[model samples]
Target: MYVVTGGEMHQIDRYTMDQLGLSEEILMENAGQAFVRHLLTSVSIDEKVIVLIGAGNNGGDGFVISRLLAEKGFQFEIWVVPPVERVKGTARFHMDIFKRCGYSFIEYEANSIGFRESLNTCSVIIDALLGTGVKGNLRKPYAYVIKAVNESEKRIISVDIPSGVPSSEGEAEVYGVIANETFTFQAPKLSAFVYPSALHFGEVHTLEIGIPKIAFTEVAPQRQLITEKRVRTTLAKRPADAHKGKAGRALIIGGTQEMTGAPVLTTDACLRAGAGLATMAIPACIHPIVTQKLTESTFMKLPDAEGEIRSDVLKEEISYIQYDGIAIGPGMGRNISKPIYEALRSFNGPVVIDADGLYHMSNELHRWCEEPRSGPTIITPHPGEMALLTGRTIKEVEEHRFEYTLDFAKKYQMYVVLKGPFTIVTTPVGEQWVNTTGNASLAKGGSGDVLTGMILALVLQQHSVIDAICNAVHIHGKLADKMIETHDIFSVKASDLIHSLPRVLRSYRY
Candidate 1:
């Protein structure tokens, strides 16, 4: 599940060969055989194959694959860019073997019309023109050949990393080859998860290319892809004798007169995520509206001076509510009322501060973190909100998500969920988890409210803060993915994600 950069992967390959005593040729053979297996099984081999080889080990892989295909009686054409003579080391060795076996090779001369004709005639194209080691913009015949192959409208398969991709940042700065399927070695690369580069890597298959297990263990990656197996193992199982109160109770405080749906979404998500009981403390005026919206959850009407929760009433209710966990600030407007501050100062349980609540805390962040009642606080902030809290711009926060998240968590002694493309959940214990779930469909309104509810539900259920956040995040994305299985992501609504939660939870065996 570790995601390494292109450079790290190259070092890992070398270490495996030198330290572990694994032969480089055997690793090449393993990679070639695995790719051939996937190609033969996943796609048809009845049509002619046109493989474009460069002058590196990636091209060596292409030569081995071409040999395997020819041995299997498959018709194919090998096109060596810069000619076979320019290929060196392992690539040169393989090229010699191919020539001796009576395989025809086409020397790519910068302006060969036959090259274009062969490309157009082939049914499939193998892109071994570049590997992960490629950096900066491509030049000359390589770029021209890549552009020509892309324009051919044939099924393309890229070996290792796609040609012209930067590999780690996931950005396609220049021209990048689009492959129908990409066969990566060892583990999934960083480029496979990031934006524009991810688009070109279709149906990625991570093949085990004869690297020792110890190498992976020694080089731990910072980012990871969340899988169903990982989620299944992390989920806690309920005992048959468990009771409702034993599962834990959660109290959510949010919602004003106009944004009554925010607290409702949070409470509903909590219930669906298996909270034993859920309670909401809303403004006295909006209490009836929230009650009507959510029949399953209990509601308390807090003092409201101008259609918002009065801080005085928050203090009064904090002593009476015997909830295990509390979630605040979903739709609570940014009103600097004295009552709101008083109530925040009084609550003394594990609290999840989000949305406008996070905005309010930015000014007196140190006091909020060092308060006597602050027991296990978690702040969920998007890039903009994070910038407000950390005194940085949105661009700065995005570029240094890890550093900022760690700094904020350590400073406040709290858990911080930095929400974005890859949500970073950092704990005060110096451990960080990057959630690789969810999708663009979650960009809709009320989605954060849903996440807040899910996290509160797990925390109230007595799960560790880290585990709760991790589980909630995984389920949040799984629900969206499940919905996308039947509905379009653009059309998927926030409420649809809430409704799918029960089914998604039930799908988990634990």
Candidate 2:
């Protein structure tokens, strides 16, 4: 689905009313009624609901919901946080109609007898005090209401995004309501998919209001939420009589004596990701250990210098290897970056630059921008590596993750896989995909190594560069999701992801 920011969503809302010829009131009515349907299925009508109403259309949605509940013989209390007169426009119309229907509200005051009494009486809380337009910290009566709702220990359902969660950029207020569920209208807010604020949105349900499909198409949000179906469709179908040579060859070049496991993990993931042939080239000193751990894949022991791969050894051995795709980094140490760059600078097939490989590229990004590669080069960088590449603080890159990644890819004419809780994959032209399948299970060490290998395997299979990156990212994260079903997140290590790849791929088989 198309992922939009708050302003973009507002434009879609406006276009629905103005261009599609749907009245604003009918749209509001549609939103409220649609939400009420979902609410009814999840909660019982016998429970008492306290609707926290504000001065905006979000509050108007609450009024409509309260009116519907009253009609259904469901007991509910409407508490207007701001003065009733502060409500205006389409919202005012809904409020006036609700009052005309003989429904009255209790004016909520901070720590007041009536407020405390309402909190004590209600079994459910409907948070409609703030919507997509929340800015800064929780303020005034909204703050007081959020505090009371949180303290109530009642099941909370937030209208659109949770109150105190900013729909725009930046972190959510720690005081935001932690709802049992969030029923969002139209598309989900960008914050709904990202962190800090995402923690506040419990079970998110997107309700389709009366917005025309054309509005969404016209707005054309560059961001998208990756789904399983998308990854499944992007994968290449192997023939019944397929041979090892036909599948594709993937080369993983990295590993010092100290960090030998990193490259082994990459090789393990490469073959598991469906590569026909996988090779791991590490320092000669570590070959004995890696050989024992990895039996199925071939190994190339580059000449060692101080227990690290010598740059000259890589240059000499690379000429002999005939691989379809290369994944460089993982544990390549700082010494071999020159040869890694030299190898990538001339090669034609898809190359995944990651780990220490990116550390070197950070120094030569200016050169890369001037003389771009003809073939695809995918860079997988966590926030720390990205900070080194862009010369920005880690916090700066984290705050504007999408924007910074898009800029880097566009400027250098390469695809960038910015790794995080929500992994963002962007092409040089500005199209982006955010994979929402991962959990905290992937935060452990060597996760990116496995991901690099997966991307290499897909790219070697001749999938489009963008398709390969997106599919690999989705599958990698999806494996983590599957792991957490039967195992704890803390116990899901990088090797576990490799072990689970077959299960993930089996579900996608036709």
Candidate 3:
């Protein structure tokens, strides 16, 4: 589904009206009716509904809802933030219709007698004071009204978004109504995804407001919310006649003596992700630990320098391994940074670089960007790691995550998966995808290692590089979601995600 910004939504709306010949009145009417339908179905009928109106299209929606509530014999009272005569155009038309329907309304001013009574008596408050057009902080009487609504402790259902949230980005105003539910038109706004602003829009419901489908097609939304159906379609179907060799072969290279579990998790995840065979190449010191823990995977002992992979290990192994894909990092300490780069520069197969492997490439990102390679390379970095690679503060990395990912991917000519609540994947050419699945359950050690393994297996299975990365991200998070359904979200382990893969994959399979 498309995730539109305020400007994008406005362009689509204009296209709907100008090119498609859809009248604004018809669209407003549809929006109002949709809001009423959702409100009536989602909330209790016993509670009195108070519809708050503004001077714009959102208020026009409230006007429509007020009239519909009267027609349906539901108890609702309308209140406008601005004077009644200020409501113009399509909104005025709706207000006239509401008046003709025999419904009464009161214009509210800060600390007015009627406003205070309405604030105190209403059980359900519908906030339509603003739409996606909100500008800075709330001002004057509008701010006072919003504060009153929040202070009243009434259940709020906002139209489009919470009134004081700027549609562009960031948090809602301190005075903005903390909605219990938000009914948005067409697509979800960007504010609904980004934090602070996102928190204010509690339980969003995207209602179809009769905008032509062609409008969306013409607009071509750049941002999208990942859905289960879409992710399921991206999954490659398993052939009944397939053999181990045909499935794919993945080589995992990482693990220091003390951090042996990292490569172990990666290799295990590769097997669970359907890699036909997985080989773990690590320092000789950690080979015993990896071998003892991972019976399914073959182990190759690389030269070690104080329990870390030797800087020359990749140089020695490059000619020997015939794997379809390689996963680097995980627990490989910083000692052998040169061989990690060697593996990256030399490997012709898809490479997934994570953990310390990313740190090794931190300073030489420009070199990696310019180097010629046979297959796609993906770098998975959390915010701190990304900061190291970009030479930016952790705060800067987190704040401008989307921009940073796009720039790094486009500049370095590599794919980047910046993992977080909404993991963002950007391609070398700047194509972006935001994963909306998963939860806090994935915020654990070894999660990124598992992700590397999953991505390596998919790439080896011949899925397109972009599709491979996206599929791995979605499946990685989806497993966490599935586990949360049956287990405590807080107690979820990285290994739990690996264990849940069988069940998660089964659900996605036809």
Candidate 4:
């Protein structure tokens, strides 16, 4: 599904109106009726429902809803925020029709008894006051109304989006209507997936506004939301005659005396993610401790130098390991090492550099980005690591996630999984996908390692690298999403995600 900024949405809307010959009046009618259709089925509508209408196209949508409700003999009141004469164009057309149907508008007074009583008595608020055209913070009139409605404790069904919330991601405003549900048109706005903005929209359902899919042909590398069906189709089943080697081979190269459990979790998660064979190459000192937790994975016991592996020595050994994929940087410390780059130089198959391994890559990023190599390199980095890689603040990385992630992916010519609540999976090219799964339950430490393992396992399975990365990300978050369904969300741990992988993985089986 397309998740676009306000400009992109307007371009598509313009394309539909000018090229496709679809009228704005027709689109408005379709939007309002589509919302009503969804609302009738999803919510119980009773008398005393109030429609808060503004002066823009969104209010026009509200007027259409008012006319349809009255035509259906439903009792509702319409409160127009702007002077009725100010509502021009298609919106005025709808308002005229609503008034022609013997309906009248309620006057607006910010602190009137009727306004407060109407908000207090209403069972639901149909918020069509603002749409994607919102700019910066809302004006006093709209802000006051939104604040009042939010304080009313009524179920809010916002039209297109909650009034006062911008359509783009990273909307910094908090003074928007807190809708119980939003009936967005055509595609979900980008803000719906981003945090802070995402919090205002409770449950969002996209309503079709008659915009054709082909109208969205102009993607300066289009951004899309990852859906379950996309992941299902990306998944492939191994042949019946497949053996351990044919299925996939994954080598996890990381672990130290101090951070012992990181690589163990990655190895176990790799196996659970369907890696036919997983090998743990850890410092020989910690191999005994790691061995107890890993039985199926083969071990490459490397000689230790003060609790850390001798990367210079192990560079030769890593070259000999026959594997389809390698996952590096689980428990590896912050210091950059030769073996880390050597594995990148040596391995021809996919390599997932994550966790502390990302730190090593961050140190010598020029070599990785400029040098021509044999196979695909995927890096799973959290915000802080990504900040180092991009030379930007963590705040900058979080605010401009898509921009920085896409720029870094294209510049480095590698796949970057910018891990967050809504993880972004970017390709070497410009294409990017925002994962729609996962929640705060996946916020625990060590979750990235688990995701890194799943990513390696998928690439080793011989699937498209982009699809594999996206699949891994979706399922990683989905583990948390599905776990919270039966168990307490707060009870979730990163290890629990690995243990509960089957719960979500079973549904994605080809």
lDDT of each: 0.80, 0.85, 0.82, 0.84
Q: Tens digit of lDDT per residue, candidate 4, span 1-510? A: 888887788888888899889999999999989988887885554656799998989999999998887777777888988767778999998888888888987868533457878887778789999888888767767777888899999888899888888777654445698889999998888888776788888898988877887887743327888889999998857888999989798889888898899998999999988899999989889988998887989998887787877767556656544788888889987553745665567668888899888888777777876684568888899999999998898877877788888899888888989999789988888888999888888778788889988999888887999988889998888898888988798888888998888767987883
Per residue, candidate 2 scores C-alpha lDDT tens digits across 28-72 of: 899899999999997898899989888998988988988888888
Task: For candidate 1, write residues 1-510 as lDDT tens digits.
Answer: 666788878777877888888878888888999889878986565889888889999999999999988988887888888766678988878878887998867778743778888887888899988888888778887888888878899999999888887677624244789888899987877776555577788778888877887876666545555666777777766778888788778888888887899999999998888788888978889976877888988887777866677756666656534787888888887664434345655556678888878876776776755653457788899989999999998777766676788888887788898886778788886566766677889888898999999988877666666887888888898888898899998998878999999888878853
Best by lDDT: 2
Which parts of model 1 are misplaced by more than 4 Å? 83-86, 170-174, 310-317, 337-350, 364-377, 386-439
TM-score of 1: 0.88
Give candidate 2 misplaced runs (Cα > 4 Å): 109-112, 172-175, 314-316, 335-339
Candidate 4: residue 27 lDDT (0-100)? 94
| Residue 243 in model 4: lDDT | 96
- Prediction 3 global C-alpha lDDT: 0.82
- The residue pairs in collision within model 4 are none
> Can you list the residue pairs that collide in candidate 3?
none
Instruction: List candidate 4 stretches off by more than 4 Å.
Output: 45-47, 109-113, 171-173, 218-221, 335-339
**Stronger candidate by lDDT (1 vs 4):** 4
Candidate 2 TM-score to native: 0.95
Q: What's the C-alpha lDDT at position 475 in model 2?
A: 88
Query: Candidate 3, residues 283-343: lDDT per residue as tens digits?
Result: 8887766777889988888888888877776776555347778888889888656545655
